[model samples]
Target: MALVELGRFNRNEAHILIGRLDSEGVVAIPFDGEASIGDGSYLFIAVRVLVDEDDLATAKAIVESAA
Candidate 1:
């Protein structure tokens, strides 16, 4: 994979969208999930989707639509 930046997603958001992307047959590689969104200690999940350059638009659209 070229390691394209699919998007920046927090824990709750990633947890919600990963399922939808899976259903859409979009390959996803979770980059990290150790950072907290707010001042709290709770961890967050940041994922990267391995999509074709041409499919970046569609992938972004899918993530946005789910949000």
Candidate 2:
């Protein structure tokens, strides 16, 4: 399954969305979260939320509704 981007968000927000997706049975992950750390400018960097291509639509809806 190819991973596709759902959206970009701050680390905390990405984690929250991951939890939301988890609760909804969608497997989502945040990329660049660790890379954003150690610079103290982590907030300036956006972490990407990725999900399986097949789950893209459902994950998008869940994210949109939470917005």
Superposition TM-score, candidate 2 onto the true structure: 0.90
Error of 1 at 23 (Å): 0.4
User: What is the C-alpha lDDT profile of model 2 across 5-64, one tens digit per residue?
Assistant: 999998889999999999999999889887756878777788999999999999999988
lDDT of 1 by residue, 1-67 (tens): 4547677676666656767777887766565565554766545345444555656777799977765
Q: CA lDDT, every prediction?
A: 0.65, 0.91
Instruction: State the weakest 10-residue window (summed lDDT) of model 1.
Output: 42-51
> Compared to the true structure, candidate 1 yields what TM-score?
0.62
- Our tally of clashes for model 1 stands at 0
Q: Estimate each model's TM-score.
A: 0.62, 0.90
